[model samples]
Target chain A: MIRSIRSQAQFYYGGLVVALVSLILVGFNYYERFGRLKTLDERLDEQLTIARPLMFRGPEERPPPRREERGEDLRRPEKRKPPPPDRFDPLPKLRKEIEVARFREGPQGEEVLASLIRDGFYVLGFKPNGEELFRSENAPDAVVPWVNKRDRAKKRDRDSFQRWSGDFREAIQFGQGRGYLLVGTDASRLHEGLNELMLKLSLVCFALTGVVLAIGWILMGKALRPIDQITKVAQSICEGDSNRRIDTDSIRNELGPLGRILNTTFDRLVRSVQQQIRITADASHELRTPVSVILADCDLALRKESSSERKQETIELCRDTALHMKSLIESLTQMARWDSSSDVLKKEKCDLGQIAEQTAKMFTPLAEEKNVEIIIETTPCETFCDPLAIKQTLANLISNAIHYNKPSGKVTIRTKRIGKSNIIEVEDTGFGISSQDLPKIFERFYRIDKAREIEEGHSGLGLSISKAIVEAHGGSIEAYSQKGIGSRFVIQLP
Target chain B: MKILIVEDNQRLRRSMLEYARAEGCVADAASDGEEGLYKALNWDYDLILLDVMMPKIDGWEMLRRIRERKTTPVIMVTARAQIDDRVRGLDEGADDYLVKPFEMRELMARIRANTRRVENNPQPCLEAGDIMVNTVKRLAYFKDQAVELTAREYNLLEMFMYKRNEVLSREFIYDHLFDERDETVSNMLEVYVYKLRSKFGKDSIQTRRGLGYVFMPES
Candidate 1:
């Protein structure tokens, strides 16, 4: 959801910027075209002003007299039909007998008239066709013919029009000429059409920018597609589907870091869950056996005529089982406490060898019942470990050994100082382990094929619990065995 | 001695009754707290075998009531072997606490030990016909002459004195007399009864044929 929102915002703002720039470009083009047209109109006006003398002959020929003067009835041009395409030529419209400046302003009238006619300006000379140029009755009435003597030299001042006209005529003889009366043409219309074209081009450019922005937004969304999938997978994982994995193989980027972190966390959680299941199942199974035995024994004793001896036997059985249950509960509670506070073991030091001896003596009868010799060979040794935990570990290992040993077998327990370490070994002549079962022997409830062992229902927790205790004591335990031979367990304490 | 067992579990109650009868006590049983309390409050018994768990009134309450009325010795019989439970049961007016599924022999021993304290009522002469037993010296006086008896015989005589009128079964005789290894299948109780009768006269100890032997004391 977040990814889509970000992508949409990118699209909207990106499109807006492109359209704005295009609009500005269009406005700029319109401005440039408008400026060009205005300059062209001004040049046309100046040319008309230069040729005024040829047409009206004096400054009194100003149109409308600036204020309250009779206006010249300059007739509008007749609407001429557009030429056919086949006969059309690339030339501007013009009128015949348009005014042109002559010796009144310059002496080189012939050259000036030739240049004017060639350049699309009709330069009708005054002497040749002046009357024809002014034949219209509506032309400004003050247009008088130029004087050739003192009447022409009305003012001697340099800034006066008489002196200026004399200078203009001299300059014209030296190849400088004035203007012409430009007639009816479509130049203004052409300027307006060019402006329209510029405006349209600018609009197209704006439209192109819009299309580019749209495509950019879509491409960006496409490029970030994998990110969206990754985000969805992340959300699912956070929602407790720890097994949900990001499967995008595009692992060359930041997503790889996220995927790896999630996978690592899930793996740890899975392992802990598996351990928890095994622990609960093992505990329940262990509890069920004793409870079933007590219940069955009580049931039997209850239903029949149990003699004093038989009644006593059943009661004793119940007592023993109840004690076993109590001990098991106590051990579990202790283990739980230890699990929560393992650092408490660091507070004390005790002798593990003596504890091992005491543990071995506890099962002396069980060993003797099988004609087995339990030999406790040890050097005096002490270590900084939980005495209770060490005793429990030793008892568990020795019990397992006794339970699995053969008749007339020798069970040897040896503790020694091996180069600054306390080493304990419990070896028994028993039906040993197969190589295949070695790896998982210390796993909870992992009994080695119970049918093959002589003991009935040997709880597989002995080794597992021993391993836990040893590890908690900063120690390591290992087992070595071969089928048909004896098994040996060795523990090293630091 | 008439004993009352107040156990909730039918099986445990029956077994315990059987155990008490084997120890030569005239045992009566109630299956719940209310029945136990009713029996315990009204009846005169040497010992009350109370189980902890029961309907209505439990062993602790029954024991408390029994102590309040008669001060009769009450022994708690329970499967809850927790030390704290035992301590609590004892603290609640039980004379002793025995964890159940106990050995029949151990139960008999505990019952005897608990009843001994209540039997301190001064009886200068404990007599049965020509046999006049001295309670203080633990002596058997017979035919105007003292007859020396072993510790086992003395205990047997004491049991007979407690239930002088009621017949004691042979199964009841052997349990209190012998240990676990004694072959109870033999006619051991008959042998002991014959010996006692011969020494003290057969008329004093009446044989009920198939039922058992009864000590008929002279009124």
Candidate 2:
């Protein structure tokens, strides 16, 4: 019951019920007592009417002297003391004290009388005969009787009974006396108790609610703390801190899967970034050596005799080294661009025949110088692809062919359309790839083991970039070679 | 023949001087632009060897100040071997540009080429109106009276006399006078040309609107 009524509204309703019931119960009890008192007065009034004529027959047969008037030495003299003339009557002559004594004789009647008295009563009329008619406590009660009484100033013998002289005469004239009968229990004390109970309960409930809300807020914060930490770790990863890892120990519930996913992603990111940094550092390091060689060689040539014969050789060497440096720088810059965004192939509409012709033309002069036979076979093939990337791919393959070719060697470039795809092949009579390097050529910075000793300036990124470009263009590049034989590189673009 | 070598790099400068000496030319060396400018301004030289990238007033500024009072031929040397560098050097008052760590032979040939113009082109232009520039000797004859001209004025007058009727763009004329390094051509060229005109006669070089000045031969 207490739990159900623990809330503020329930407490208030419960208090109201208790207060209202007390008021109604006490009020009903007081009304029952008053009703009984009115019935007793009615009976007493009937007896008084029977005795009144007998006593008033002729004044010869007088009643005995009143016990309060005559002592033991006097003979009884009963003359109907003529009922006195009307004068003083606040209440009719009703015996109120006697009625109250009779009503108290019942079970629980004491409690009833106690309630009525606490509610308070009023006496309407009184006489020296010690009889009176009065309203019950709770004020508005009506059953009051009338009586005759003397009203003489000289009848002040302390023993001469004073009486209500006017009540019976007025009652006789008016037939019945009328007055209010008020019946109710006193509400002030019971209501004060109920008010005190409500106030205390309200104060307690407000404090409890405050404590509950504060505890709930704190619990929510504590529960989400690990998730907040995981969010921070994820944000760090977004900011390029690939080495950052989630605190697996602190993570629980659904976050365990999240932590595992993040760890896997970070592992992949670290590998790729490390690969790029190594390639860039290795390429720059490799380039510095050749540049130093060129500068040194040029300086020496300038210092020596100005023989025009040796001069051409030095200038050609310098130019070759410069071209190598430029390619290396261009490759590094492209890698940087890829790292910054996507490595996907750039696609555009390009004339493959034109590109092939340009490539062949560029290598023609070098081929003529070496007394080699160069041939180009192509159809008027056009495709959607990154023109620069495709051109670069072709240049790398053809230049590598020419660089490694022998005197009187043959170089052939062929392009053709095969079903919705364009295919290009570069074939050269040169030292071919070893079987071990065939698979690893597409890996960044992976050079051939045997070729490393002979080739000084190949950063090994050219084939990897070519492969990337081909894949980006939705194409593929493949190599087939045998040592001491020729090599062919085939590119297929869709 | 006398040549002035004004490179700041000691090794390259020494090597080039040796090459010049081998060509039977007296080569004098100045290690920086400031020293080079002082030497070239005070002495009469057939050629000046100027380095484009020099400290404490570069070769371009040195040549420009030198051209203010002297008409000595200058050749610029630079380490950046770009073609744009060569063009800029030549435009800034350099008669020639040679990129270094250059071939000693190339440097020598360019030097010979520049000095040849200085020694040969200004001679024997006998008439510009009533004036004759004597070829055999460094003398000017105007109306048969000896008319002396400062070196700067003579060079300016010589430019107008050569392209007598054609309008020469300010840029072309400035390049002719100051080479590529002397970038103050817009103002400096105007001042020098004005000085030359006032001495020779106001109407000697007629200004062509939206083009440049033209040397008009009176009909």
Candidate 3:
């Protein structure tokens, strides 16, 4: 639906760039999030290691308890040793250790712990009695209860917690078989950083898409400029400016060849138009002359006080003019049929020799008027062709020979076969055509001797019509002539 | 007046010659441009009717060759009625142009106009002293009085008036006054001259012994 090529090209390129950029952005965001989660877990493990020593009583401070004493204490659960009167409780000891460690570490470690606490990270310690022994002031309210049960179920000396709350990465770890520690770190900043990077990348991608689309629109116009020019030229030609042509020299690449072909087509179109105009003009001229003669003769016949004899002569002249006009009209109609390419040849197997002989015989009387001899030689050549059209063509040539011949000139009609084709030749000892006029002899309305043609009542279309008929039958007619020697018309049919 | 018609169409040329003769002009016609050009160059004609399309040479070429030597007034008669053809004909020294299928009356009028132009006489009247012959009306007058004459007598008088004071031979009179189709005796021209003299006055025609007759009007 988008009519402008520029917009279409921009949309395609921009869509592809945006799609690829979005895919890459999504991939990078996922990888970054994964790395952030792993790093948070490792940081939680280190914090638990630092807190483990503080939570457990020193191993050397108490003798190893007897196995029977541990078993009997567990069997008499509540009434057994209410912890020897001198036994030290580890809850207060773990709290004091956490405070000492938090205070004794170097300034960098203390700063790291303080910042972690400020950013909503906290640590907790749980005792073997299934109770929370210590909890940091910033610890989440759910940490003690959750860590007490998790620590009692723990079977290892060191473990890590994995939990998420809002924007924090929380973990529970137990170290040295003493107690469980809970650690939570704020991961919202890392997520926020990744989100910000994605936003910036998206914005860059959009800007890049816009820039690329704009450049593409302009470049496409530049590339298609030659097509626009060719279209404009064609439009002008359609509007009747037949002389208009595209400037092919300025075009290069693919459009260059296209422009040249279009120019050639235009040239042919113009030539045909000019030729049609000429034919119409010549036809009207030829048609009008006979009418003029007839009209004049009639007018003269109707003159007052004219003798009957004069009137009779004028009437005879009118009748002759009318007949000439009829013949000229028929010739013109034939030419028109040929021009329209509507005359299909009626093909039949017929002998070229018989046609030539018959046509020559028909012209014998006329030839004898000028004392010209008619000669026919045939080799029984048989061919597939339109017999009527072939006979007409031969008749036209023979008539032309008789008309142009001097007294006692010879006309020879010969037919023979050569290879796969039949050849018919009509040679005349008449006044041969000049070399200059020989080439144009077959053109419509072309006459080497217009006066002779008029005197003989020839319409000058005989040769042209003959050529068209021969060509329609898959044949060619050619004439070879010398200025004064003689002319030969040759027909080849396949 | 003597006129030449050079048309390629045989019937058209023949009809034009007939019309020229009927109008009392000695007209010679050629069937093609080549013959037309040949006659036009070799002879003096008061007017020439040339067709544009012809055999060896065309009217345009013929006119060009004719203009190179002679200043004979030419009227182009052709079937091409395009304005370009008319302009070309006139530009090539034609005195007038008549398109084919034109009214015979129009051609005759053009012939008259062109011949008048050549003679420097606007009226279609020939004059020798006090005798005036109205060519269009086919009438003659002597001292303002209409003179009754036959067509042949009038033609003979007009020919004499056209070349007054010049001796015209018997053969010349016969050639001008009669059509080629007409068969006339050698002394037929003498009868026309005798009739013209009796009607106009004996002094108007002078006998030149064995040469011919001359129209020498008395001062």
Candidate 4:
């Protein structure tokens, strides 16, 4: 639910760390406690078993010791003694009972049994006459409610086991009609050790979770520092310093594919903004002259002393200026459309060769008047493009070639397919663009020969429009020129 | 007064030159800043109308080059209408800044204001002795009577009135009064002096032998 990745990761991962640590700690505590207690219980069982045979002073001289079979053992005092041998072993085994007992071998077994009794382990026995036969020093004779496990052997009493209802895990058993013996070990220290371990582990889990979250926060901050820097750069760009950029070099784990993406995006945005500013200023400047012309024409026409011929020329000039404005507006609109989207391409399968031929035919008269030879060498250049747009671009290039050509210059329009692309080239033996002006010719409203160009009423949008249209078709246009030698324009359509 | 128009756009230049001529001023135009700077350096134009953007050299460089030698009133006409651009133009020694798509009337008014400032006469009306001239309407009055005058005669008279006490040389008058396209006559000053002498008095413009002519009209 956290909005931030760092916070969310810290919350969930910290919870997982806590849960895993607690589970491992509890499992380990219980495992060690169970192992130690099992060893203690088995030792107690063995000792009690070993000492059981020493309990009966007289094996069977007396009648069966059934007096204390029910609940009479608790009335006797505690006992610790070796039991008699199994004189009644051949007696019906169904009347016999067995319980756990253990003592180690050699003289060390006696010391172990003594230590076991000292460590809250006990052995007690009852006499046949219902008195306290023998008791370990630490044995007690408190009344007890036993939980018994009945033996499942063929001799029903052979493996009889019983323990107290309390946590001491004590047990007692007896042979047939004889007083039962007791053997039990105190295991409270195991529970105490486990509880202490749980406490320490809980503290460790809490501290570890906190440390993990803090480290996660620090590392996450390091990972996300670029966002702050990028945001700062974006803000400054909005504040009019478009040249400022996000420093992508020192950044990692950026929002996009990399920091380079955001930097490139900002670069593109700044470029577009600058282009837009230039276009606006240039368009206004371009429109100003025509407007001035129209206004002056109107002023001249309105003068009362103006001759009829002068008025006639004024009207013509105004009309021409109006037409120029119209064309300028059309070019501006076309550029705007392309800027928004090249969706206006409306591409269709066509041949660039045929388009060039048709465009050359349209310009044949002008070329002839200028004494320029028009040559069209075309192959079947199959391509997908908007035919009208392609023809217009060709017309523009051809017209420029003718307009700037020498008196006897030759203009050639060639269209052919090269590789997987369709190529259309217009080469001319004309006054080519200077090197400095070549790169700027495709910019809107840029003219090389200002005086001659202005008089011709060329809006300087021809090459710009041609480029726009060509690029809209997913094509590229390039110009190569030498100052006085020639100029060539190439269009590559994919 | 003679004026120079330096504009990249041919239509605007020609049209404005015609309008200036119509307003009774001899005007010439250049197509770019390179040509404009050449003409500006060689000629003593009363005013220079400059376009900011040009093919060879831009207006700022022209202004900078011009400011090093001449102080001819320059009015920068450009489409860059930003306040910073205007301030920069003025800071670069331009006399005025006019944004394009401006009304012809506004442009003419600004031209007149700048030219008058150069002439040390901010007001449109100039009165010397008994002769009063309204430079805006190109009208002159003598002793409470309107004196009908041709554009050239009026221009000559206005020049003399503006520089009333100073003796202007023949070359100075000729160069300042005529545009390059004007058909100059060697005796044109004599003809004009004779014409003005009959209207005003002989004492109005007294010849100083080898020096020049100075107007000394009395009230």
Docking class of 4: acceptable
Model 2 iRMSD vs. native: 12.2
**Candidate 3: which docking quality band?**
acceptable
Could you estimate the TM-score for every candidate?
Answer: 0.39, 0.39, 0.65, 0.67
Chain B TM-score of candidate 3 stands at 0.82
Model 2's TM-score against the true structure = 0.39
- Candidate 3 per-residue lDDT over residues A1-494, each given as its tens digit: 78777767667777787788888888888998898778877887776555444454332433345546556554554654444553478777667567645543547445645665675667666765558765666876764344435444553333455766666676765443455556776677888888898899888877987787788878888888998999999999999999999999999769999999999999978877876786777778777877887788877778786789988887777676677667777888787666655246677788888888888899878888879999989778788888888888899998888777778889999999999989999999877998889899998878776645655578889999999988887789999988777899999988
Per-residue error for A447 in candidate 4, Å, reads 3.2
What tens-digit string does per-residue lDDT give for candidate 2 at B136-193? Answer: 3435665677766755455556556656777988866655454323357378877877
Error of 2 at B28 (Å): 39
Q: How displaced is residue A380 in candidate 3, in Å?
A: 3.8
Comparing 1 and 4 on lDDT, the stronger one: 4
State which docking tier applies to candidate 2: incorrect
What DockQ does every candidate get? Answer: 0.02, 0.01, 0.49, 0.38
Q: How far is B195's C-alpha from truth in model 1 (Å)?
A: 34
Best by lDDT: 4
lDDT of 4 by residue, A412-476 (tens): 99998888999999999998888988999998888778668656667788888899888888889
Candidates 2 and 3 compared by DockQ, better number: 3
Candidate 1 Cα outliers beyond 4 Å, as residue runs: A1-6, A30-34, A37-211, A214-219, A228-244, A294-441, A446-459, A468-476, A481-487, A491-494, B1-219
Scored by lDDT, model 2 comes in at 0.62
Interface RMSD of each: 11.2, 12.2, 1.7, 2.2
Alpha carbon lDDT at B68, candidate 4:
99
Contacts from the true interface found in each model, as a fraction, amount to: 0.00, 0.00, 0.75, 0.45
Count clashes in each candidate, considering only residues at least 3 apart in sequence or on different chains.
Answer: 5, 26, 4, 27
Ranked by lDDT, the better of candidates 2 and 3 is 3
